[model samples]
Target chain A: MNPAPSSSATDAAPVLQAAGLRKSFLSGEGSIEVLRGVDLSVMAGESVSVRGESGCGKSTLLNLLSGLDTPDAGTLTWAGHPPRGDRRAAFLGMVFQSFYLIPELNALDNVLMAARMLKPPGAAERARAADLLARVGLAPRATHLSTQLSGGERQRVAVARALMNSPQLLLADEPTGNLDERTGDAVIELLLELCRETRTALVLVTHNAVHAGKTSRHLSLHNGVFQ
Target chain B: MPWYLYLALKQLFPAGRKFPFFTAISVLGVALGVMVLVVSTSVMGGFGREIRRWTVDTTGDVQVRADGGINRPADFLAQLTKVPGVVAATPFAEGVVMLEHNLKPSYPAVRGIDVERVEAVTPLSKYIYFGKLDDLDDDSVILSSQLAAAIGARVGDKVEVYSPLLIEALKSDEAYLGRELRVCGIFEIGHQALDSSLVFVTLRTMQDLYGRRGSADGFDVKITPGLDPDEAAARINAALPPALHGHARSWMEINHDLIFILQLEQNMIFFLLTFIIIVAAFSVTSSLLISVVRKTREIGLLGALGGQPRQVAACFCFQGLVIGMAGTVTGLALGATVLTFRDNIVAAFTRLTQSEAAIERFYQFKQLPAHYSASYITAIIVCTITVCTLAGLLPAWRAARLKPVEALRSE
Candidate 1:
């Protein structure tokens, strides 16, 4: 059974809901069923960590929940309704294993990119981006290019970008995968702290049990189902 | 600014960095192409303009000729003066003559002009180098500079002229000899062919030599300023009496073949030079294609962050537009700078090669000229920007086709 929710997790509406989600990939002639009939739900201000072995469909599940890929079989909703194009930027944020920061933009600009997706950034948005960078401990490196930053600093900048729009939910797909053990611990702590303080729900997908244990609830993916 | 435009600029210039090498290389390629186009088109236009000016200066704006010859010169002159748009008119006759000076024989075209009226129709006095146009009398002739140099003749020297009329006189068993006239002046019209083999004499003297009295071959007419020569010629032709059997031709019509050739050369150069911009645009396409491939994951991040496919495409499209604008502006500036010093550059080049005289002989121009047509420049700007903007479409399509999940999963 999953652990009890943190105090920040309310008995209110769930930020994300997915039922009977399924995905398949073509491998040669026949197909490989990557994901089959998964169900997941996370409440506002709650942090849920999903741990799995290699190729356990954890990333595919995240992709489905984030609506980046179409699930062949089931229904999904964001805050009780269908996902919308216009609201996507304001409704959700995503972090990746690769950091995926645009090389041309500096840390501040990279963080501001998320806000820019919603609208052209004004002074308020700029201040918020700087504040988020400071929250993630990247205030000093705000002007540094992605190439100029260390791996941990880049990941922190990505975290700041993910929260720039103040989305209701944040999906992090092994964001600390490329960093060292010490840096990875720090990134996980920062993610959990920010999510709780902002009252934003978090779905953390990772292979590290220590990182997974830090969240309010933890589930392990075995085969294509949660165990 | 929109995020896509902002990103596009950052990609090209990239904050906190020196000029990007890729951007610089692409911009320079387009700049060189545009510079060549501007310089070449301007020079070609200059050649055409200079030719037209010289032609209208040597001959009048319009030339009136008869089916046989104008039988009543004085009557025709009075009638021409009454014609609307006719500023002035002068009578003339021309034929080839064998000229001998210092025992050297040369065949040259000779024109007989009305000394009093020629100045009103054509500015022949401005071309006189050694003597005055008023010095030209029935007993005197003005030799073209090159012809005078070829036969070692100078002002006040006497030269013998043998016209075809002398042969006809001999056939009739009439005692007629070649007319001898003093060279009263030397004129250079700055045209190779005109300055090389042309002579001028008074009309009465020419009539005495050719045995054609009280007649002229044609009359050269100058029209009111700013009036179209072709329109003036048409008016003159319509006003002439059918009994005269005369027609008027504009200077443009007289040199139609030469003007056509010049226009053809200019168009061909423009057509050929356009390929350089196409080549540069292709390079831009290539670079953007590579950028799309390299930034696949970042594109996925953009999509995941709620950037629509069209917005993603705009990012790449805007890059091409920025490059084109920057290149065109730089190219025009560079072209203008180079044209300003074109004469100096040509002088240096000719001096180094020791071909100053040969260049003058071959090009028939001592100084290079340039003319910038507004229409031509506008076409270049529009065409170049369009080609460059279109260049981005393929890469943008490729970028937009990427599925966010698949792109993010790309290793």
Candidate 2:
């Protein structure tokens, strides 16, 4: 009983923890509640999948946890830093549904752009960006504009750009939704390989029960809470 | 990399298929704005100075006189020299006179000057086309080429001088008795103000009309270089004896109307030509807006990477600034080229005309004046930059305040 009193006694490493979280979206009529006093714990170096129906607010919960959006009432912290420009960008990396690569920049330039954001005056930042681009197997296309890359390559660049600052948390919102199953598996494997090597906490928001089996922690979002 | 300006610009103008069009418009706006400003500015600058010189060379900087009389004392000329900015005080007499040739007479303004003192004040002696400055001492007169040709008189040809100054005879006062005099000199200034209406003679000639008194109506004084005419006049005015009220004025004041017109033209040209710059700025803004709209995904990505709202705004603003700067540089180059060859260009246009003489008379300038002052150049540059930065505001704000979620959602 005395040892169970400490919060660290739980299996979770407390990469991110929320207590009695609440969120409501204002519709034309009034407000539609999205989450109702939910509590959850996610550990460091654990990959979790959230599955729910279309209107069950799985993305909303992931956004809240990643600090992309704020909950109406909740206390959440990640890597000991709250959501802010530098730390948030450094702590969490999100793969949006529609690969948001800067179109004007080349693949390496895109990755370099995010790296530049991390430490502006850092010397040899370009070489580091080049290394990151090469690691993503885009060495030849480093100077090719994002528009030149195929959907898969574009997504790969987006993934590489996410890791530009070496993020501590990785969030994938239907990372495979836009690709064929074969290509999707390749991306999923890439995400898994990168996250495992970096020891990053991972969260996947998806409706595919198949993806749920790929993670150690799986939960169903129902009503306004997760169980 | 992280500065709001660099990031925003980097995001807004990604290399794409549309890059060529954007760059071209930027160059065009700059070149057009520069060309128009250069031509207009240089022309107006020349017009004003020619008018100024036309007046400066005619009348000495300051004209001093006894307030209530037609003549000043003999010692006045010597006393006038002590005044500051009085390089030389030369005595002169002027009166209306008639010149008769072949029984046909024409009237003109006549001035008599000392042969030596006038040398320092005017270049009349150097320009005598048909006669010499030394001949001013002869009983022979110097008739302007225009008046001489009209009267059918030439150097060594005799003409009668009928003075307006009257002599009192036993019965009543009468105009001076006519003198049959030889024409000794003829000068051609081509300045209509000088050529058509003026006649010069030796100071002794004007004295003879006044019964050989050898006195003058007033003295014309010249100022040293770098001296402000108005200030010199003020100093001379204070230096004068109370008996003589000196009228002091600048060369600009004497030709106020012509000067005013030149200034007005300069202003109108400046204002009208600035629209070119404005149009360029508009093009810059438009191009950047297109870039921002096209790069919506890129903007969204930057936002996702922890780009602050300010960074988005800065990027858009920076793109606009870049366009503006490009236009400014292009304009400067364009303006400089036009200004550099302004003369040859105008001469070419004038060559297409039927008569070079007619162009000369109409424009009153031998070569187009493209006088450039540092202030003028600075003004054009500042104005261009202002409009350029202002043009960027709307797109920059749009970029800055973009909602990351919404922007990412844009296709």
Candidate 3:
């Protein structure tokens, strides 16, 4: 794996910071810990990857970071303040392994979902959604439903949706886990190029070592702690 | 254009022809419930109105009676006719009397009315099926067809009538003073109670028999067209002489029990039919619960994208509202159509079943009746929507309470 980029003087302050994070799950008769005393910080425009074996809590850590799940004992702050209420969606975006696109909506509508969470989409938002679909090379398929799209196209549409609101931090959990090698590589390349163009920070969780090598920083999880 | 509304519409009528079957059934259930309620209430209201109209037409809209009797009916009739809505007023006397025909005795209610003014006060003249109302005289009586049948008397037959006063006189003197009257006509008003109990004669005959000269029991008043009987009665009461201790009452007051029973029956039917809608509303709850389960992951995705729990709940509620609206509109249309063609439908059914006597024996009417009111329709719509919305609450609460983590973790 490529080594993380050297610390630079011009880098901005961290957009996401989590410290002493701990999480547990109840399995049958006993409680099992998923994350333990984990600390992480991601700067603006920085790309980071977390790699681990299955059930090693990489997805758990990503969920906690994305605010989709809360830690048992930890403080997570977005831009130095606790992400309370709907402020998290304003600042952060997430991509899942399953794409999680609403089946009822078309690809363009799925892309517009983030922007429309708090309010109705205007003409400008609609135009931007169309542009994002074009950028993802699926403009012709914008009107197609999730069931009609191929796996790679669905993931690409999901990527476009995650960027709809131009969030400062993007957390992706095994986004390419359901794709073939060629389609996975292509999706990853497209995602990285868009993140770089927008100067958005990325925290990706993956099992692919080759994919992890493409990020600026690489980390591994063992025993519920990142090293 | 709210996001939740958009989500609700998308979920309810999903693309690719994936219509929610359970939701459609729920809507249909509400529609049928509303349709039945409307049709039932309308028919009941029509029946009540018809009965009231018949009562007023037969007995006059308002009746003015004195404490003992109107000792001088001319002044009373003149004053009553001068009232604002009084169209016509006539003096009438009534009593229970025993009539003997061929030595078979039958008690019937005897009424005395002025031959000329009776036509103006009541529609009795129009219901005359034999002879003429003008033929009534001191010695001639108009017998209701039912009373005539019971006494085995016919037109031109001599019937012996004994008044209560005559019976009292016979008890003291051991001699009966009775009137041998001829049946001048037979009338049938299509009301069993009135037809079986009423006999009409001239005002002089009742006065002479009861020993009340130059007086009558009361005055029957017909109000102006379209005037409410209660209002006319009120006006008459306000104008009455308190010394006479006279009272005026509308036909409705005379038959309050029957009217009350009709209204109560209608309300009971409405209440009972509403339960059908409530049961239908439960279907909405069940369908929404299923939707919540099927869309758990999508719900989590929405939450992660910043949809609040309240918004999630509102989404399901909106879906319920849509279903209610659809059902209510369709049901109103269906109900109106059914009511409009009620007579035809009933006739068709009767013909198909070949049960002609069933309709006549049960309803006593050739055609079914229905009355539609705007207020009633509005109430039904409001009631149905409220029920549907209430039914949506439980599932909506369950959906809102779902944890994003647990939901996303589900397949």
The lDDT values for all models are 0.89, 0.73, 0.86
Candidate 3, superposed: residue stretches over 4 Å from native: A1-6, B16-20, B67-71, B82-87, B93-215, B223-235, B238-245, B349-366, B373-375
The DockQ of predicted model 3 stands at: 0.56
Docking level of model 2: acceptable
By DockQ, the better pick of 1 and 2 is 1
Answer with 2 or 3, whichever has the higher TM-score.
Answer: 3
The TM-scores, one per candidate, come to: 0.94, 0.83, 0.84
DockQ, all models: 0.76, 0.45, 0.56
Write candidate 3's Cα lDDT for A112-220 as tens digits.
8888885799999999999999999999998899999999999999999999999999999999999999999999998888999998989889999889889888888
The candidate 2 chain A region of ten consecutive residues with least summed lDDT is: A1-10
Per-residue accuracy of model 3 over B261-284 as CA lDDT, tens digit each: 988998899889999889988888
lDDT accuracy of residue B30 in candidate 2: 61
Best by lDDT: 1
Ranking by TM-score: 1, 3, 2
Per-residue lDDT of B18-88 in model 2, one digit per residue for the tens? 56566667757866886688668767886776666655665677666554533554567667687777897
The digit string of per-residue lDDT tens for model 1 on B1-411 reads: 999999899888988778698888888888888898999999888888878777877779999999778878999999998989999999998888899999999999989999999999889999998999999999999999999999999999999999998788889999877789999999998877788899999988887777788689999999999999999999999999998899999998999998899889989998999999999999989999999998898888889999999999999998999888888888899888888899999999999999998998888877787899898898788878888888889999999899888888787
How would the docking of model 1 be graded?
medium
Decreasing DockQ order of the candidates: 1, 3, 2
Residue pairs of candidate 3 with colliding backbone atoms: none
Deviation in angstroms for A175 in model 1?
1.3
